[model samples]
Target chain A: MDDLRGGCTLELGSMTSALKAQKILGTAAIPATVVKTSASGGGRGCRYGLRFSCSQMANVRMILANENIRVREAEWKDGS
Target chain B: MEGRELTYLDNAATTFPKPRRVIERMNDLMQNSGGNPGRSSHVLAIKASETVFECREELSDFFGAAGPEQVCFSLNATSSLNFCIKGLLHRGDHVLISDMEHNAVLRPVYRLWRDGVIDYSVFPTFVLEDDGRKTKIIHGILSKLRRNTRMIICSGASNLCSMTMPLAEIGELCRREGILFVVDGAQCAGHIPISLEEMKIDALCIPSHKGLLGPQGCGAAILGKGVMPKTLIEGGNGINSLEADTSGELPERYEAGTLPTPAIAGLCEGVRTVRALGIERIAEHERELFRRALIGLSQIEGVKVYCPHHEGSVLLFNKDGIDSEELCLALSERGICTRGGYHCSALGHKTLGTTNGGALRVSFGVYNSSYDVDKLCEALREI
Candidate 1:
């Protein structure tokens, strides 16, 4: 994971959304993990996303976009 | 009553002897992963959340929902109906319900009407009539469609009798009229086939304990895509913590409190059992039992079976010169389980013209057989 804002992390809306993304990624054989973002780390108080490797960033973005997930490019900021 | 076998014919109330997998899954959840689902990020909490979400996905697939997000768990079918009828209806909106609707549908709609928030019409289900029933029902609904009619609520199958609502036809009518179609699947979820999408239903409310063969205390309101209703109740869904409003997600938006994870886990397994056994097989089994009961009861002197030609899972009748409740008590004394009286649907009683005294109901489950049917008839004859 590289150091950037939402770069390696896919900012899905909720835990359900993140789990859905994980399932989607799983079927494609892409690697992802459900991570809870802290208030200061991601965009809001409590957010969930799929944290993946920096190298898979482009593929993650492209695949999720195809599935209408609408994830943004950001860094995997560790929660406080 | 000691040491005697219980016939257990009141499945319309709640099923007894749930599937083995259902009980095992619930026990497994409580003992192993009894954490708050979607609340914390701990190991047990994550397991609970995953189990709950898996149930959501399983139900969504079973009911033909768009995705797992559409199926929201609740306490039971009554709460789910309240959620849909209350959440979906706006001020001044008109709704139509079938005459055979249970109190689950009638009570909430009555409250909204009493408060002057909305008005409703009761269309005839013709639940007792056999000839041209579907066409008559469709015509009845078309006649009752007001200009502001927003939704049409009907049961996929009646709780009182085996007469089934023509859900596909009613769904098509609602679609053509641009009204939401909601089906109360409390009596038919596992007994008969239902597809939310193919039937054009906006929402389908089902109870886990009844036909689905899950334990009591859980049900769901499965929504179709783009049918988001207003929240009937609001609370933390582990999303949008700081915000005053709840999360704007499919299930979390409606699911306001901590979900009944154990019951949901059980419901998931229950639906799996249904899928493995095949709903078609279950439907015919009940129908065959109903046919035997119909013949057996009809052969008895002074016995009457309502809607005898209309066959599914439930059958309603009463004996001549015998009080309905007294008959039920006598049957109970003989180790037979059955229901009597209005069965909580005044509308249904009026429709069936059973206002003097309500009929006795003997409902069947997949576990029932000709022996059970014969036993019921034999007990009734002795009574």
Candidate 2:
């Protein structure tokens, strides 16, 4: 639901890593929606990423760091 | 599970009577999340990706891989073995394999040698009783080591008989020599306790349908921390779609094309079932069944059981004056499912001196019991 409400998305480079991040976040009671991340030019080649609420960015960062999941990039999208 | 009441003893080829949960999970996956894994961000695709990754995670934990990404899916152990063998070895590299290797390992290495990409040697395995046996095997391998030896590949357990390679010892040797250690875990993954890191195994090739008790058409190459082989077969694995080359990742680099989500789902449940039953308990059960079949067959007149000293999940033997194929056919007529001829193991049959007629292999699984052994013995007596 948080993903539907305007939040931050963290690109994790691959589906395996995105799923891994999702699982780790779930254990921490954070909801995440796995999304296909568009490349820098927004073309066909896509990586996997996680979409979550912007307010949980701090907690997500801390959890991901502790879990050693390096976020390739992060961008915020308005949930309009 | 949905077939006739035949007594299946060819567990070495592929384990039958998969656990109920494995079937259930596979069915559930097909019914619910049937989509290509890692292909899209849609709900079904995401779920499919999750299912595949979950299985990867399960297999990684089961085999003691560095992480889930290290587990790469393939058609079976042969494909994984090919991927590892063809990808890892370079020109002028010398590979050492044991005498009990199945065709999966033997063929690729043979082809590589014939293609002039590498040189290879076959080291013999000797069982000298308890503590001294490992040393003897190691000594045999040490004598065959070449200056360019790049890898040592062996069966975790022989598919022909109960003979098991001293993998930890060989792995230790490879680690010390800075040579890669790879194991064809066709007969040992679920039957034996293996820690890839602990054993310093660079790669372990396994089949989902063998000791794993999952459905066929799926397997994995569980790579160690630093063992990254070149891509044998490549296309797209939902990553780096723009690049002409494959991904520079752990499994995605290897697992090209479509992922077998349902089979992987079955495998996840299968591994869970194995853990539930306890690997030690299951292995002991098979060994006990093996002991029973061994004793029963030995007592029968004109029956010759090979490797009577080795206790394991598989036993090989032949009846006197009977062609192996004929005996196997007779057993089949009696509703006993077993393998005859060379079992696709030219090296193993030669090593065991059964090349002339090969032998009958009766492999035990968790679902099998002493009753099956008794039935096989009684049938042998009748035949």
Candidate 3:
């Protein structure tokens, strides 16, 4: 796996929405992965989030915006 | 009898000899595109997701839904009705349904009533009527409306009698009264034209296998503007994976788990075939067969035909001395397939006053022919 500290995560409302967003991003050629919500992030339990390389964070956001998929929140972890 | 050609007249239960294209499309999906939709970024998965979305769009357009998002897939019309009825009604809410509804609608509402979650009433359906039947039925429904009545659920056509309900008028009544209207289109979706926008229907539950010519295990609920039922099932929708509850979005809010992608592919072709052949033409052909069967059965001695004037492709009747089951079995020995007894619509039998003896139902489809009708009439005459 890539360094966890060098990636960005997007919290979504449900798994279906996340999967739909993932498909749209994949069709647009943006690499993304759906994963469990971070436990310590005050995130809603049993939710999912999409993680991508920190370097492509802006591009991913722009693509999701174009598709009109709402993002509940975004978080970036910094490398030590 | 062993080598005789089979005559299938149980279309109301589920259509047979599905459109050629529907069969081919389902086979193609099973063989070439078996990826789990919306589960990953692989090429097969992406292609599967696209196919599912395209199917949704096709269904939405065919039903005149607000958009593809307004369409949600389910196992069958019963599941769709459960989602709509349970999601929309609350404790103490009053619901109105017609007496002709199948068990799909009746059972769910009854379960809710039994649990004291809600209460419902069955309104009357009109028989062979003169000029004022529509007006009388509408007035009867309006008279029963109470301050607590929140929704009206009805079938587009009677599966037992084959009588087409005045849905557009009923929908108008619901609109003016500000009551939510839902329709069970199990017997009419592919045989009739339904425009959700024009009909002002809040929700429509349909089975793909019966009228849409698709395989079993596929159905859809089309939501109209400003209508949102509570999610029936909560699970992975492949979106908002961080939430503990289901999504509040259009389809994602209702649809859960892995969809039946192969059935949906078949549904797409089914709708396309219906559109290409024209629903009116298919309906007309079935009506012709229904008319011939009705005339022939009515002339037979000791045969009592019900709903003789119903314009749909179904006919219900019984012989004076023969039990409906025995009659059906005799017909079966002659290679004819018909459904006897209550047909899972006990309420419909009650309405038709056939509760005591039940009736044999012979339903037609686009594939049925004059020869099939003639064969059925000949068998009835002999028995």
What are the per-model numbers of colliding residue pairs? 9, 0, 21
Residues B1-383, model 1: lDDT tens digits: 44226888888988877888998999988887799887776778878888988988989888899888788889999899999999899999999999999999999999999999999999998776668988999899889889999999998888898878899999998899899998999998998888899999999999999988888889999998889888988988877677788865778878878888899899999999999999999999988999999889988999988888888889999999998899989988878788999998888889999979899999998877799899999988887
TM-score of 2: 0.95
lDDT of each: 0.85, 0.87, 0.83
The sequence of per-residue lDDT tens digits that candidate 2 reaches over residues B1-383 is: 22448888889888888999999999988887788998887778988988888898999998888889889999999999999999999999999999889999999999999999999999888632445778889999999999999999999998888888888889999999999999999999899999998899999999999888899999999999878898888787787688787864677878789978899899899999999999999988988998888889888999988887889888888899998899889988888888889999999888888889898888888888788899999999998
Off by over 4 Å in 1: A1-7, A40-44, A70-80, B1-4
- Candidate 3 residue lDDT tens string, B128-148: 453576788898898899998
Report the C-alpha lDDT of model 3 over A1-80, residue by residue, as the tens digit.
33444577786654445666766777877777766564524644444567777777778778878777677764655332
Worst 10 residues of 1 chain B by lDDT: B1-10
**Candidate 1 clashes between residue pairs 3 or more apart in a chain or in different chains:** A4-A75, A5-A74, A5-A75, A6-A73, A6-A74, A6-A75, A7-A73, A7-A74, A7-A75
Using lDDT as the measure, the top candidate is 2
Score chain A of model 3 by TM-score against the reference chain A.
Answer: 0.75
Predictions' DockQ, in order: 0.45, 0.57, 0.19
TM-score of each model, in listed order: 0.95, 0.95, 0.85
Q: Which lDDT value does model 2 have at B331?
A: 88
TM-score of chain B of each: 0.97, 0.97, 0.97
